[model samples]
Target chain A: MLLLITRTFKESIRSILRNGWLSVSTISILVMSLYIISVFFVFTSTANEMLKEIKNKANISVYFKADAEEGVILAAKTEVEKMNEVKSVEYISKEVALENFKRTNANEPVILESLKEIGGNPLLAALVVRANNPTDYQTIDENITKATFSEEVSRVNYNKNKELINKLNSVIETIQKIGISLGLLFAAISLLITFNAVRITIYTHKQEIEIMRLVGASNMFIRLPFIFEGIIYGIVSSVVSVLLLFISLKFIASYVSLTIPTVSLMNFYLANFGTILGYQILLGSFFGVIGGLMAMRKYLKV
Target chain B: MINEENIQEEKNKIMIKFDNVSKTYKGDFMALEEINLDIAEGEFISVVGQSGSGKSTLLKLIYAEEAATVGEVYFDGNPLSVVRKKNLSAHRREIGTVFQDFKLLPRKTVYENVAYALEVSGAPDEEIAENVPQILDIVGLTTKAKKYPHQLSGGEQQKVAIARALVHTPMIIVADEPTGNLDPIASLEIVRLLIRINELGTTVVLASHDKDIVDKANKRVLVLENGRIIADYPQGKYKIS
Candidate 1:
């Protein structure tokens, strides 16, 4: 058994070396496909991280009536915090809201003069509500609108920011869908290309395969060498793609950071190094073996 | 009704038997018909026929490469159709088959081509090391072992094929038009090698159309015309006339 396996391995290596161009072209296709998959991985992961950050910043502010008591507003804030969908609720007093407005627009002298012309702070005290999940924001909004303090609530900021929120949600969802479909499409195409390449390689060896059968080689014996050849292609292409991804990510890291400071491609790749490599190897091997098996099917009938 | 002992005795005497064997392709074309023959152990037999006369088909039957369409082929009293698919390789290993085209792996060296037969059977390293050189020497291609198929002459390549076939030390060697692609000198060399192998107690079956080689073989010959045996000669020539 050991002898058979060793001989098969040696034969596989010799075949790869013998058909130098075929082997090289197959490996190149595998690398390109795997690299695309890895890039998609990095792209989707970065998009997911960005989406999480955006969700964290997204919150609904509920302003109280001008004449509403502070005690009632505080109680409402506590009530909103108790909802399952709500993460936390922060109370912003009218005075603090005005101060924040003034400080943020400090560069505008006319705004300052207009603010001074007003007799008193006209801002409403409000409770800013955060949700655990972006999808839960709608539920939290509904709950707040139907709360006991609904009469005391002047208006919910959710209605005002509804368009922006809906647009953001759809954009993120569209990206996720496109990413998944593109990944699948590329995977299918890569498998087909690899299958054809392997089929051609085996086609050239059709006579040799017949000779092997005539010499009394079992089906498994004939299959093992081709399978090993496929596996070698997978391994080599995976290593090349991972190295390509690593080096390219490293090269583009600083430049990407300058444009989108929030995204550090190198850090993302390094952090998921094992996952990236594992995916490439697993996918590459799957494609290689399946391709080889499908190609060898008709010829092995002899 | 034969007893077990008698059956075993019969198996020990006959190497191959065709019991009313017939082969037809695509239901209409009759390649062989109602042929009954037996080859004993250690015998050298040549099958001679014109093109499409079922010479190659007869060789294919012995190796179980093609099934007799309407009859049974027995190797040592074991019907080939009854042998399970998994055991087909084991049966085939007992018979070495050489083709007209040499059928050598072009990318492999002569040594690798010969050793591949033993390697596929999972022979140990020491056995391969011991047997491959001896077989190459027998085929008279020891120095050319490192050469590729394309690097050698047609005769040398056929010799490599024979070496590969012999490496397993099979009980029978089937050469189907083995000299078809070689010149007369090279063809004579292959015929001599087959004769030497038959003398070593391996049953030799040669299927050929070359009149000179077939006449020179002087072995038991089965002549076929239109898929039926027309003549069976002990020490036969290529043509009766």
Candidate 2:
């Protein structure tokens, strides 16, 4: 059994080497398809990360009266945190809020001057509430307004950003829908292309397959070498594609980080290196092997 | 009534038996008709016929490549039709077949081509290493072991085919117009090689329309004319022409 396997592998290597250009072309097609898939994964993952960040930033801050006590604001924070729709509520003291305002306007000399002229902190305490679902912000806002101590709350900013938040939610939904559709489309296209390439490669060896069967080779014995050949193609193409993906990701990461500084495409790829490699190998081998088997089905009848 | 003992006795002498076997192709074309023949062990039989005269069809039956439309073919008392589909390879492994096309794997070297037969039979590497070289030497292809089929002459290619067929030491070697693509000298070489193999206790079935080669074989000849056996001559020359 060991000898048979070793010989079959050796024969597969020899066949690949013998049909040099054909093997190269087939491997090239595999690499292209694998690369496209890898790139799609990267794109979708980055897009998902960006959408998550946007959703997290879409929280509503409730400003309280200037004289509202810290105890009242903290109680409000706890109450909002207990809401099923609310993810979390943060209590911002007047001092902390003033400090944040200063930092945010530090780049403008006029705003810094106005802040210094104002002397004491005039900013109101606030409760920042984030919801699990973007649409849940309205319910949280209405609940806060109807609370027994609603008079202590000077204003809720949910109404101010409602249109913007709704638009952001729609944008995220569209991106997710498009990502899924494109991913599926790319997958189908890549599979068809890879399968066609494999069929053509197997067609060239149809006569050799017939000759093998004629020599009294068992079906497994004849099929093993071709299967091994496909696996070799998968292994080689995957390695090549990984290398290409690494080089290309470096360029894409730098360009993308300029627009969305938090997203490092290369970092994402490295962090998921094992997973990406696993997927590439799985897809490459699946396509290579299944394609070869389907093409050889008609010829193996001999 | 024929008893089991009598059938066993006949099987001990005859390697292959055709009992009124007739093969019909699609569209009602009869390729062979009511053929009754028995080939004893170690017999060198040359089947001679014109084009479309059922020479190839007769050879195809022995290899179980085709089933008879009527009657039966028995290899060692086991009917070919009775062999399960999965056991067909096991049956073929016992009989070596050579085609006129050579059917040599184009990418494989002469050594690999011959070794492939042993490889497919699941022979150990050590046995393949020992047997393949010996067979190549017998076929006078020892020095050309590294050459591919296209790199060799027609005779050398056929010799490679024979080497492959003989590598497994099968009981029978069936050559269907093996010399059809070779010149007279090459054709004669193949005939002599088959004769030598038969002398070593292997049955050989050579099918050809080449009168000179068939006459020179001077073995038991079965002549067919339009799917019917016209003559069966012991130690006969080609008499159809």
Candidate 3:
């Protein structure tokens, strides 16, 4: 069987090479489907990565009582830091908050003088708590309240920003879920189209297959060539898909990076070159074997 | 000789047996009926009949290409009627089939066409490289081994088909109007090739309508008409009228 398999592979490759137009047509179809799927995969994954970055930028800021001492807020920061869900805790002192306020409002003279007229820092000392994941905020915020210095806290400022974060999280999640579902559906459809293309090509050469069968060729022996043809189809198409992707991304990607100001397709594809190649090869080979097996079914039987 | 065949008819020594074999197409038109025949090993025979007669049907039945409505066809020791589709390849490998159309793979060259049969049987490259050229030479196509099917003349293509048929060196050769497309000279070339092939001690069962080639063979002939074997002779002629 192993001997037959190798022979089939060699013969299949030979057959494809001999049929110039056939080889071209099969490879192009395979490449087209693979390229479409790869593009969809890149788009959704990049979007997910960008969304995660945005989530990491968010935090819960708890403003303390105006009369509360700075030491109490520092204690609150330490307590929040010790909690399992808390990713990080930073205490902003009243003076620091006042300076930040003045710096932010420097362009507005009325607000700046009003701030000087007070002749004092009129800001509350606050602790900003960051959670490991978006959903972790609820648990960690509750832990902040159960701490010994809860009286010093005027309110947990998380109450203000919590609703906005929750809404944003759901929106991001929904987009990812839809992207995944659509990606899978399209991938399956693409695979089927690729398979059918190979099947049709084999059907066209059915006479050749039957002749091969009649000559005393084993089923496995005859199947090898088809499988090899499929692999060749897969490799050629994946290379085409990748090149088309590269050139298109090379042109359209710069424009996209300029408009979006987030992801750089060139850099991403470059950074993940090995991963992309590995993925493309695996995809091409998988589709090729499947397409070949399915297409060669009739010929392999008798 | 006929009496000797009849005495051994009930025994299992025959290589092929058609027991009450019959075939009818979609309509009630019977293509073949009550086809009881036994072929001994290494016998070179020809089946001669008119165009609509059951000659081709008998050949197809011997290969089990069509099922008989009433009986069974036994090849070697196995019953073809019940042989699974998966086992068809093995069964077909035991018999080389050549058609009037030649049925050579257009894409394959003469050498490749001949080697294809061996390739399917998992023969190694050395064996293919060795056997194919030799068989082509045997069919007298050694000089034209590199030519594709289109490049060759009808006689040459038939020779390639013959080469393919003989490559596996099977026990029997079932030819269905093998010379149907050829001119008289080309047809004789084919007849000569079949004769030459038969001389190698392989059983040759050809269904041909050409009067001259059948008259010249002078071998065992089975004549069928209206789906029945109307004549059996040690030597026979094309009785189309």
Candidate 4:
């Protein structure tokens, strides 16, 4: 049995190689599809990261009365932090607030002049609150309102950030949904194109297939090389696509880093590679092999 | 009725015994009808008939190319109709075939073509190495091993086909007009090659229309007319008329 199986395997490999450029062309198609899927996922991940950064920048600060005691402000901060929706809260005393204002506006003449005109430190002690999810800022604002020491609070300032944060959340959500839907759609299309290509190759060899059946080739013997061919296409195409993607992204990231000085494409690529590698293999090789086997199905029938 | 054990004993060792098999093509045409034949081990039998006489049909029955429309064609007392798909390769592997048209794989080298049967069945590399060349030598195909079918002469291609048949050391060789593509000399060469293979203890079944060749074969001949066997004789000479 071992002897027979091995011989069949060797013959199948030979038959697959017989198609020459036809097999290569099919593999090329698989590579293109896999590359498209990989790049799309990369773009999706990058967009996700950008949206997260936007959410991080949308924190709301609540000011307390100047005369409010430290215990009251600390209690308010703890109460706001304990809310189910609120991510975190930190109390800033008047002195710390004033120092922060000076540090931030040191290069701004208008802010400095306004501060001097107010004579003493005009800024109030505040508690800065951030939500776990950007969309939940409204719940945080409401929780802060019903706090035990709401009477000590001079003003709650989450109202201004609420609309902007919600808008950002919706936009990011739309992007996520669109990316996933389009990614799956195109991956499915790619799988089909690759499958069609392999099927055409098999159809051309239909007579030879019948002959193989007549001569007593087991299904595995007939199927093995074609399967190998598909896997080979997937692995080869993925490597090509991945190398192209990485090189192109690295070049673009360098330019973006120089110009924007804020958007770090290199950092994003490095941070999310575990996900990218998995997606690439899933899209390229997994899809490629399935396409190949599906294409070979009709021909493989004895 | 007195020998229930004898029936089991008979079942164990019959090489090929077709009780009654008739194949009819579409419409009212009958390709074969009511054929009863028994071929034992190591028999060099040639099926001689004109076109449409069902000689090819008989070969097809043994190869299971087409199922018998009525009655049974048994190989070693096993039903051909109900052979499982997984067992198909095993069943076909046991019987090597040479086609009238010399159905050598056009793209494969002669060596690869000969070794194809083994390859599909996953024969080990060392065994393939040992057997393919030996079979090629047997068919006088060693020199043309690397050439593709299209590159070789008709005789050489047919030789490759014969070599492919012999590679498995099958119980029988069914040659369906294997000389149809060759000239007189090439045709003679193929027939002689079949004889040589038969001498090596492989059962040979040759189907042919050439009067001169069948008359000279001097082996068992089963003559057919209109899908029915008209004659069967040991050491038979061709008498198509």
**lDDT of candidates 1 onward, in order:** 0.86, 0.84, 0.78, 0.78
Write the residue-wise lDDT of candidate 3 on A1-302 in tens digits. 78777776776766677667756776776676677777766665666666576667768888889998877777777877888888888888888898899889989999998888988787888888888888777787787788788888888766344565667567667766766676566556646655665666577667877787667666666566677777777787778888888888899788989887877877777787777777888888888887667656643454
lDDT of 4 by residue, B119-138 (tens): 77767768988999998888
TM-score of chain B of each: 0.93, 0.94, 0.91, 0.92
**lDDT for model 2, on a 0 to 1 scale?**
0.84
Q: What DockQ does every candidate get?
A: 0.58, 0.55, 0.57, 0.58
Q: Which ten-residue region of model 3 chain A has the weakest summed lDDT?
A: A293-302
Q: Which digits, one per residue and each the tens of the lDDT, describe model 1 over residues B1-241?
A: 4698798666659989999999998958899999999898988999998999999999998998888899899898899987635578888789999989888888779999998888777788899899999999999999998999999999999999999999888999999999999999999999999999999999999999998898778899899988999899988788743
What i-RMS does each candidate reach, in Å?
1.3, 1.5, 1.5, 2.5
Native contact recovery (fnat) for each candidate is 0.69, 0.60, 0.86, 0.79
Q: Which is superior by lDDT, 2 or 3?
A: 2
Question: Which residue runs does candidate 2 get wrong by more than 4 Å?
Answer: A67-79, A93-121, A159-197, A200-203, B1-11, B69-72, B82-84, B105-112, B140-157, B181-189, B210-220, B229-241
The parts of candidate 3 lying over 4 Å away from their true place are: A1-7, A14-29, A66-125, A131-151, A159-196, A250-267, A288-301, B1-12, B24-30, B68-70, B82-84, B146-153
True contacts kept of 4: 0.79
Model 4 per-residue lDDT tens digits across residues A85-118: 8777777889998999899999999989989998
- On TM-score, the candidate that comes out on top is 4
Q: Candidate 3 falls in which docking quality class? A: medium
What's the CA error at residue B176 for candidate 4, in Å? 0.4
Q: Is the docking of candidate 2 incorrect, acceptable, medium or high quality?
A: medium
- Model 4 vs truth, CA RMSD: 4.0
TM-score for candidate 4, residues paired by index: 0.85
Per-residue error (Å), model 2, residue B201: 1.7
lDDT of 1 by residue, A1-302 (tens): 77678888887898789889888988998898888778767866776776676677888999999999999999998899899988888999999999999999999999999988986988999999988876787888888889999999999887344455567667767767777787788778767766776677677778767777787777777788778877888888999999999988888878989987887888889898998888888888888888888877855575
